[model samples]
Each structure stands twice: as C-alpha cells, then as structure tokens.
Target: MKHIWPIAVMALALAACEAPPSQEDAPFEPQYLGIETRLLEGDLVNFHVEMRGARKTRDIEDYARCAAAQYALIRGYGFAQHVRTQVEQREGLWMADAAYLISDALPKGVTNIDAEVTVAACRETNIPTV
Candidate 1:
C-alpha cells in the first residue's frame, strides 16, 4: 500500500510537468510572396518564395532549415531544385519569413507569369487583383 501510494504520486507529478505544444512544435507550412512582375529577379524566378515555420522567428535554429525552405520554394514553383538559393528573413505569425533568392535565369515557363500560383498552405500575398 505504501509503495503504491508513492508510485501514484510520482506519476501524477510527472504528468503535471508535461509541457503543451508550442508554435515551435508546429509543422512547416509552405508560403510564397508574389512580387511585382519586375521582382522575379529576372527570368528564372519571378515569385519570391517566402516561407515561414509554424514556430516564431526566435525558434529558428539555423540557416539550413531556411535553405531547405528555399529549395522547397523552387520546387513549389514547378522548377527543378538544381539551382542555388539564399534565404532572407521577415516577421511571421509564429516564425519569420524565409525568402529564397534564386540567382539564375528562370526557364521559359517561369518567366512573365500573368497570374499568381498558390498552394494549400501558403499565406496569401497582398498583390492587388485587377
């Protein structure tokens, strides 16, 4: 009986100490910020691939995750992930925006796109619709 009471109390104490999931615990959601026709950085990447983690900026551990997000951005654009990309930063709901800059000339299908491409998870960019 004494041992049972101690075990029960220990279990209750451990359960009380368990932390709830934070924004950092959230999964990665794909995001993109549509820039003006002129902002695609030339032909290859017309849309700035902006990604934010479910966690806030303070939770960002390193540039590698940002880099992966950049690659994912290019992949999100229906382009090959062969090219190099750089990650930039901005504020976000839980995490900061990671901007992947594609430095090469975009392929023909990518250049001069008239409409914005969207995915299920991306937060919409505020480009005025004509």
Candidate 2:
C-alpha cells in the first residue's frame, strides 16, 4: 500500500540520520613525555608536564599533580598544597604548568595533598611520577 511504502522510506531516512557512536568508547592511549621541576621559592615548586593523547585538560593537570606529589616525596616532604595549574593543548599535545607548596606538615588549604597517598594512587593508576 502507498502508506506502508512512505512509512518504510521515512524509517530508512531516520535510521540514516542517526548519530554515530560516541568516541568515548575508544581506548585511552596517553603518552607522557616528561616533567620539568623548578624550585620557585623555599617551599613553593613548579612542575611543567607534557603529554600526548590526553582525553581532556584534566589529564594533563593530573600528570602535573602526580609529578608534584613525587617531587615532594623526593624532597622528604609529606604534603603539598596545590597553588595553580595552567593547561594548554596544541596539535594533540597537552601541557600543564602547575605550582604546589611542599611542606612537612599539612598545608593550610583545601587543595592540600598527601604526597605518599597521591604517589601511591598515581602508581596504581599507571600514571608516571617525577
């Protein structure tokens, strides 16, 4: 019947217009380039991290955080307070410049991170540290 043919065509058109599957299902393959550490002041330190295949800016930020945690531990510090993190992406390469205050006692901030705990987490998550 004419009505059945029209319905079938409309269904076919609708199916063709359906959106493609989401890219979130793709495997995350991130390559961490390296990290540069600088002593900004007495307790303040800066970390510059670079990576590729980052899913978002948070990935680069996390990389910097991991570096800061490990760096603090290396310096015999027990805690680090996050100051700021700047992230940029260029041509599939992501970079973050992060600052943290390394301290023996817990810093007075909401962003304070336990170096030992953070380093352990980073290792468990397969993220490299400085």
Candidate 3:
C-alpha cells in the first residue's frame, strides 16, 4: 500500500507540472493585451497607456513585462517621459497605468486635446519610442 501511494503521488506531480504549450505555438485570441490610451496634446502630449484585463494567474512578471514593453514603445516614439501609472485587478483582470510626456516639438495649440490612438499608430506616428 505504501509503494502504491508513492507511485500515485509521482504521477500527480508530473501531471501538475505539464502545462500546455503557449499561445505562440498555438494561435488563440489573447485574453489580455487590450490597451487604453488617452492622449493630451498641447506643448507636451501626455499619453496614458494601460493594460485592460482580469487577473487569472498571479503572474506579476507578466504584468511587469507588459508595462516594460509599453513603456519602451511609447518612449521610442516622441512621447514624454512618464507622468503616472495605476494598476488594479478586478474580478479576473489586470490593469496598468502609464503616462508619457512630449517635452517639445508640439504644434501651436492652447487647448489640450486628449487624443486616443492605437498602439500601432503610436509607434508609426513618429512619437519617438524612447
């Protein structure tokens, strides 16, 4: 009986370790990766980018990686440095807050226009992804 229990435990351990392949290997619509962008245009354009989704896994690393990627993309363009970012998990979604600043090279405008643009457009718009 003792030997039988040991073998069963080993089998269960192996099964638990075997997580299925990643989405890259198999194409599946990503549950997360939705972005919310609010652009404040004027002398300095403030881009507030964040991740919108629930928290299924307690993967802090994943959220941090997402933030890094977004920050890199925004800085690469010509956005400002960073203003603020807020992150919250509701129900089963994860969220992040990011703000970028455009120090110079702004068009003549006294009014502040919050331009909501997509991530792709943000990169190609010559925003200087620093």
Candidate 4:
C-alpha cells in the first residue's frame, strides 16, 4: 500500500515534468500579403515580403525566396544565390527583407537556387511567386 502510493506520486511527478507541446506543433495557417521586388544593382535584387500567421521567421524567408526565384526566371536568369534575409514581426504581421543575386549560370555558392526548381516547389507548396 505504501509502496503503491510512492510509485503513484513518482509517476505524477514525472508527468508534470513532461514538456508541453511546442509552437511548431500548431497547424500552420500562413496568410501571404504581398511581395515587392527591387533592383539593387546589376544582377542583384531585393525582395520585401509581408504575411500573417507565419509559424516562424523561416516562413517569411521562404516567401521572399519564392519571389526572388520567380523574378530571376522572369529576368532570364536560371539561378539565384541567397545573400541575406532579415525578418520581423509586428502586430501579427510578419515581414522579410531578402537579397539574392540572379545569374545566367549557377552561382558559386552552396545557397544557390535553380529558379525553375524553386518556382516549381513554391507552386507545389501553394506559395505565391512574383
């Protein structure tokens, strides 16, 4: 009887120590607002993306990436290299400022993206592209 009570108490303590479900476990319901493209320089482009209900910063970054990929394809570029991305959230709105270098050939970097492939993926994921 005493041993059973102690075991029950230990089990309750262990259950209490278990971590709660994380935010990542929540269903993603992203609302993409829009994308703005800027020609920073020759072959360099900047994308400003806005959205809501983003699960995290990566969601906004991916939105910007999709815009950059489509823009590169429209500009007759086959590839783009990721340069930088800055993300912020305010009043439930998420925004990302991202830069990429569009090129006719594959850029020299691990972060390079093939425009066609990226655009296809974005479409498959139901993400909009410019």
Best by TM-score: 2
Candidate 4 regions with alpha-carbon error over 4 angstroms = none
Residue-wise lDDT of candidate 3 within 14-121, one digit each (tens)?
999998876346542325454444555643233322233322332322343333335444445422343455556675455555454543333244521122233344
Better of 2 and 3 by lDDT: 2
RMSD of 2: 1.8
Judge candidate 4 at residue 106 and give its lDDT: 88
Question: Per-candidate TM vs. native?
Answer: 0.32, 0.89, 0.34, 0.86
Off by over 4 Å in 2: 21-23
Give the per-residue lDDT digits (tens) of candidate 1, residues 9-80. 999999999998775567655343322222244423322233355244322312223333334344444322
Model 1 C-alpha RMSD vs. true structure (Å) is: 9.2
- How many angstroms is residue 121 displaced in model 2 relative to the true structure, after the best TM-score fit? 0.8
Which residue pairs come into collision in candidate 1? 40-46, 43-106, 44-106, 55-94, 55-95, 56-94, 56-95
| Candidate that would win on lDDT | 4
C-alpha lDDT of residue 10 in model 4: 95
> How much lDDT does each candidate structure score?
0.36, 0.92, 0.42, 0.94
